[model samples]
Target: MSICKIYFSLFLVSSFLTFLLSIYFLILDFSLIIELNLLEFNSSSLVMSILFDWISLLFMSFVLFISSMVIFYSEEYMAGDIYLSRFILLVVMFVFSMMLLIISPNLISILLGWDGLGLVSYCLVIYYQNAKSFNAGMLTALSNRIGDVALLMCIAWMMNYGSWNYIYYLEFMKFDWIMGLISYLVVLAALTKSAQIPFSAWLPAAMAAPTPVSALVHSSTLVTAGVYLLIRFNFSFSENLMILLLFISSLTMFMSGLGANFEFDLKKIIALSTLSQLGLMLSILSLGDYYLAFFHLLIHALFKALLFMCAGSIIHNLGNCQDIRFMGGLINQMPLTCSFFNICNFSLCGVPFFSGFYSKDLIVEVMSMGILNVYIYLVFYLSIGLTVCYSFRLSYYTMTGDFNYLGLNSLSEYSFIMLKGMGGLILFVIFSGSLLMWLVFPVPFFVCLPFFLKLMALLMVSLGIWLGYCMAKLKLNYNLSSLDYLTLSSFLGSMWNLPIISGLGVNYYPIYSGEIYTKIFDQGWTEYYGGQNLGKNLSKFSKFLQLLSNNHLKVYFMLMVGWIFFLVLNIY
Candidate 1:
């Protein structure tokens, strides 16, 4: 209790201060890079760079803010856990790492935070210490290591400029192949970290973590780190890379949204929604509307954290049951949590005047007006519908019906401490969109599109709400449409077989060949010709030497006979 209180106070105070500072910096249109030379050896200057731009400070504030809420919530949610202190420490470490990432513009410094996120996140994902958590943690870690390697390559690529501070060279890397290489590496790093497309399986898989950790990770810290990195380096992307990012992020957006609609796990549904939003951020960033992307990102952090918090509350009330299929009519029992959940869902669906609308509606308009092909346009809007489709489906399945899943007592709404933490952010989730929009952009983004194009956002949202209601309206006796088209449902539900692809498809051959190589080399021919054969030969030689040393009859006889035969042959 004392530890949680202490950290919560620290994070909360820091968040308020940084958020105020971000506002100050934004009004001044100012950015300051504080460079402390950690080491200056010859041509290489290793500097600990702290960037205090509006973006970094603002994002840092959000990270700290959400982290405080999560820690506060975990106090109640994780109340009886023996290692609560340890869990709190891991969360603090995660927030600290994210802060480090937020403030650093240097690639080397970023890696310190980048690698910290991977290591600490893996620890969080496996906090339960169960087989499922263990597997999720492994997948999360290995998948992120790919990004770690890519960031290392970015560092290496930046070495050509005689400095690791890539911020000083964003434009330089744009036209030149040397710098373009860094951009490619950065994109790859971001893709893996953000869980886009092929690397996406880890995001949902990481639901094995506690809900508080999920609130921190899937919302504000680890997943958004990639989006933040790309936001900083948005200027460096080449035309070809931008196009490719659009396609991949669009698909990731669609795939995750589709997966969520088919998913039954409450936490996984939220996780998948996060995946979809990440793709949205990346997609808009690719469209060269990074300000709006960052806006959506901040707004997303607010609600997604709350979404996970509410999900955690429900899951706790259900006695750790995460299936939405078993949940119904929770609104009467858990009215506050249900209200927060649906508000977040409405925000997620970009309902008018809500926090999500200010950012998301703007992004949709911008994308609609941007120079893009028909395929991208379609995927973009379809992903939006799928997002709402899943959110409403999740709401319907969990909140609309009776509390008959576990028992009446299991679904009580008495956890005020948890609700207290959630209350701190609920107002922000509702109004931060308009509030931040007014602050972040002095003059609004004016996009000129046709009447029908403007209607698309609403149309898709309405369609999604209708479809979600229809889908979740199924009775226990109703056969799931998902069950009818098992193959397609499985494909979509499994993230288009990405987990299998990134898991088995990626692992099978290397493991298979590794086993073969192990047998043929380490355990077979190499063993025969290297260590074992050498040992056998050495043993034989040692025995022969022992016979000579022992003055054995056969050894002595052979030696004496050979000496005599040599002497006789020399005389002849």
Candidate 2:
């Protein structure tokens, strides 16, 4: 069998096993939740509930299903590649780890599974091993490690107070400083893992990986880790802590929305949009609305995966060109691909009657319910507008306008296998939201509104597309810089180090203005502030460390001689 066939088979097996497991969990309706044992010798056994819950099991099923689809999609998407075997192995490993992590009952087990998942994701990101891809892989690894450490610390802190099981803590937990710390750390971990502000840079860089990898990363697993964590432990987050999470998440959502709007690279636009969606998820999670967040996650995964796959087809057909400037009139050449693209893009904008509309409306309703505060409502609506804007921008650039592709004749339709996968995903993206609406949270008006929202979003997206098309047709240059910057800044977060001061706090800011002034003026008789120059100051710090190391080496040599003398005396 071919490598592609092997990978496809592996994906099917993994997906089927996970689906069976989810069903098994659903079937085993456990009567008892907590079975704890305490003994005189001091060991305690706390067995929290493990049977499937409506929310968690539903999410687990989606993760399994989406992952399988992406894997199947990859069979065609990544065909003819040399590392097909390695890709298949790593992807299957990723699917396994993600599934295990989500279903684990205890925090310790979850962390262990999460660590493995993170490692596999990193491997997948750098699967190409090119310079840029490698960098993206390294950055993703570092960011995820930071998140893992925070989660570990939170778990350790919780264990100190005897709360290792996730389900038990949610029900029996009380608000305290340790709990607050854990909540904050967990939020941080979630934000980083989900590619929220400040930690979002790596995601755009991650576009350097293969399109299949992007489809996998965005839709099913990696970025969703933080969200899964948040929802899994919703009860433990507490009230005030949830409020804080809501604030941060809202801010992240607003920013990422703008950042995605301004991006030009097809993959990076999707990456930024994924970050925005994560922020939205975080915002909802903070409201203690786990159901809404999970549902939205499901919808987002289906549509986002569709978008990425569609983008992949376009790029593949166009000879690997990713910039929108080189793509135009692609609709004529690849009608099905364009159709799928439109479906996913419409879903992204949250058009009524679409899957995105239902999920997004639920989120909006959750915010309106105001489990946290009135401010959350504002953030939600603002994010809604921003979401519409960015989604429109994405659709406008790729699907609409004049045939400006430099080498027009070079373009061709995507391969048969690729079309098959894209077609399946497009169908899902179009129908999943509507299906889930009836299945999970049934409401007549709510279900109906999504169709309208989808239409409205489509109208807005069409307007943008038309404007872009006209510019191309007339050969009039419309600079997208302003839009691009809006997107870029939203995700960029304080242009390097500014946020360290503003967001984290002045006490922790690496570069202190007051310290520089003190060093310049407070030095004996020196009237000038040479310390104001950052370059010279860093050089001096480097020299100071060097001197300290030199003195330490001399002390080490004397200590070695003393050790030798003591040994000689003992021998005598």
Candidate 3:
């Protein structure tokens, strides 16, 4: 009937069917690969390959499920917009591109999907058409282009093997330095795609898009593409490369975690949390357990999608206001939405028995069981603590204090459609942790350590809560004591303002050179010689014509005589 209903039904049915199929594949330990010979040439058979395994099927199911919810959610979320159908089309394309990526093991096929993601995400990010959206979209597209180039180079390099399907050579890449270069390239692509330290600016800036797009892109599709690729290429990484990834992931985690504490924009705060969690996923993957990485990935996706949806509801009800400082006492008005928000925040903090707890606890124990040096150990635990810190800080600001924003009486949870969309996910976010753990990892990891070591996770979480309370504490009496530590709140001590420092530094030189070239070549040379000079000559000729043709018959006769003289000369 309606546009949202059509897409919702389609994606919902697909999600259900694929989820069952994924279970089947998982239980039977089965994978189906189909190859179509596109061209048969001399010593090479270029083929299109599609691989159906539990990972692809399950990931597709998740994408479909989230899409269904988002589309259904948009029934209300985007009802006022005139371009609703166009937005729906963009979202559909995004989900399908993600599915295409999930199924393809061939580098060429993966490129089709990979490039689709980059292009569609750019369009979606710029959908609002404001300067902020335009800038964010450009940043997103250009940053991802680096990864696209790396993937393209990877395809060219794989041509030496006479096949684009690197799935067959996963183990071989570990042994050969030449193929190992491909792994390095793939890692480079993943790092850029996943928004690792240097490339991470685009992730938060992309919040300029609609909240629904943020939910889909940041949660399960665009950002996860990189981590999923790494998981697929897990066996291919050399030990040295893995260690390098470990350090980079650690830095990314620490950076984002610290950044979130300073962020006031609610969507940006959640986006930063997504980046932090992604760093956690990559860090675990680098430590040689791709399963834990995927586990955390799925777990994070569930709660995060719901988290973003809840955030969207809050922003929508607040008349597009996203600043948390102006929002308070939401629990008194929009109790249901606040409940959902707090639950998601708790899950994010990896509170015991929640969905994030199962996977995060496992990962933490796995890291603890391993012999790691001091810096890595502290970074991992501290980042985890920071995760809790930001989440607590967000909740304390939004739900605990008096309503300080303009629309105090206007706040209410009349968004049944949006709540219904979030309703589809809350159960999964709460319970999927244990279910997935039992299903995927039957043999639990034995985390044997001393009593103090075992209590470290609890300690970090407690410290995070205390720090969050301190940051969010009200300074009603002009607390001079708190002002003394303003450095940590505003300047170098906080995220080191790194989203600016790290993200901007890489683009500074190239952007500066382009500006200089625009001024010198474009404005100075091209403007004067190409368009400006042409316009000047045309203006002079037009002035002569205007001078001659001041509604005078004599001028007209003179022009006619001149034309006749020119014609006579040409004829002669």
Candidate 4:
């Protein structure tokens, strides 16, 4: 009857439902036979399948398990928030939508579920309704819409080719221009959805939402949507555009990794790290190796979610302060939290004997197969190095620093329940390396290699940890405003402090010229950056439309004459 009891009941109900689905998925997983059905109904032929495939069921199982855990986590996590009822509703809706997305029979249903998930996530993002949260929600929703539009374009293209079904899309393997267009559109969709390249601006801004929102959206679900889409469309995607896709993925990984390097906000840095890692996943997806990519996705989701949740716990305990500069020596005050955070962070670095090690090695191993294009291999390797840079930066600064408590009077430890949840996830990240290797690829020799990728992973993690610790020892202030000034001074110099750089750089004489040419062309970069000023500048255009509105009688007479002219021409 109480609020907690009601939410607990709902969580239990959702967990039970997912458990049932997982059972069904497992049954399908063990069954070797895949039943394909070609049925004609309602004047349309439909090709559907009982997806008893190993990969689909495996991913479904992980999704169900993670959703259930998130439900449990939210039970305590969202207790303080006022909109608990609405939050629970959206959370349940998200789980339902994701279930539909993962198990949909056709592209249309998958898209429907994908769009639903996006909508619910937007609702979650704006749950606080503060100006900052609202702005974040709008940006997230808008960026996702860009991806949604790309997906729609791809769907339309596929429909025109009469291959709305993914299976059919794969079966028709002629690799035509239409297919290429669809592939490119899908990649664009993935890039935007996963917060890659230019579209990545929205994600770090998305940290304005609640901590749970960051955890759920960035770590486990929304950021992974694009990766999941790539996996779902694997057969179609892997055919011929692998090299081009590898190049783009490499660029995204590098750029986002650098962005994370420059960022100081804990959430923003992790957000960028998420983008970079997702780029790595996309790179693996480009290789057409579904098993490796999917496994990596699973491990990444587990540990990344754990890290985000730990970060949330830290922020919550510290009175909602998210800046790393204000946090230091938290391990002394909150040992359990620090330990769990470190476990997840180390897992993120792909330290040998961790789950990240196994999954990341798989991806790098596959990249090494690109003998002719060793450039891809180098990018992949460099991405791992960047991963170390950001991951260690996150760990040492927040968890193991010089007790830089920013005048906070009290610090509370994380709840036992939260620690228990984190501990479970940490265990997963610790041991799932061996579990996944044995389950997916049971080759003993391949699993047990020391002088190869494991050694590389260990060396990278150590070097990163040492370098980051040394950098932190120098007591570098992890403040963005300072870094911004430094960057502007170094990169922009005299242009840095200008009131309006573009405006100052422009030639005003062109605007002053007594010709209509300026009106036609010289709106300039200011118009793009400052749309309100652009509207003010374009008042003349508005006045012209106003004049048309004012002279409706003349406009009607002109329309009548035009109509008469058309009629006379037709008669002629």
Whichever of 2 and 4 has more TM-score, that candidate is 4
C-alpha root-mean-square deviation, each candidate: 3.4, 11.0, 7.2, 10.3
lDDT tens per residue, model 2, 1-572: 86556656665565566456545544563223333343335464544334345455566666666666666777766777877777877877887787667766677767877898789878877877888788678877887888899988978887876666656666555566676677778778887888776676677777887898788888878888889888876776777777677777777777766555545678877787787788888887776668778889989988998889889988887778888766766777788888888888778777777789888866775455443555665566656666666565555666667666665365666378778777766767888887876666544433334455434434544554454344334432334433343443332432233233233453444558668756667652354344445557888999998987879978788899999999999999
- Tell me each candidate's TM-score: 0.92, 0.75, 0.87, 0.77
Give Cα-based local distance difference scores for all models. 0.89, 0.70, 0.88, 0.69
Q: Alpha carbon lDDT of residue 170, candidate 4?
A: 60
Supply candidate 1's per-residue lDDT for 265: 80
Candidate 4 residues 58-135, lDDT tens each?
A: 565565555555555666777777777777678767767776666654667667877987898888888878987786
lDDT for position 73 in model 3:
92
With a 3 Å backbone cut-off (N, CA, C), the pairs that clash in candidate 4 are: none
Give the per-residue lDDT digits (tens) of candidate 1, residues 1-572: 48988999999999999999999999999999898978989998766888898999999899998999899899999998999999999999998899999999788779999999999999999998999899899999999999999998888778789888788899865798988888889999999999998899899889999989999998899999999999999898888999999889988998899888878888988989999999999999999888989999999999999999999998898889887878888898889999999999999999999899998889988988874988888888888888888888888888776765755465678899899999999999998998998898999778899899989999999999898887777533322334343467677777777888887788899999999999998899889989999999999999988878897787879999999999999999
Q: Candidate 2: where are CA atoms >4 Å away?
A: 3-51, 161-163, 369-375, 442-572
**Cα lDDT for residue 511, model 2?**
52
Model 1 clash pairs? Answer: 328-401, 329-401
The weakest ten consecutive residues by lDDT in model 1 span 475-484
Candidate closest to the true structure, highest lDDT: 1
Off by over 4 Å in 1: 37-46, 474-486, 515-572
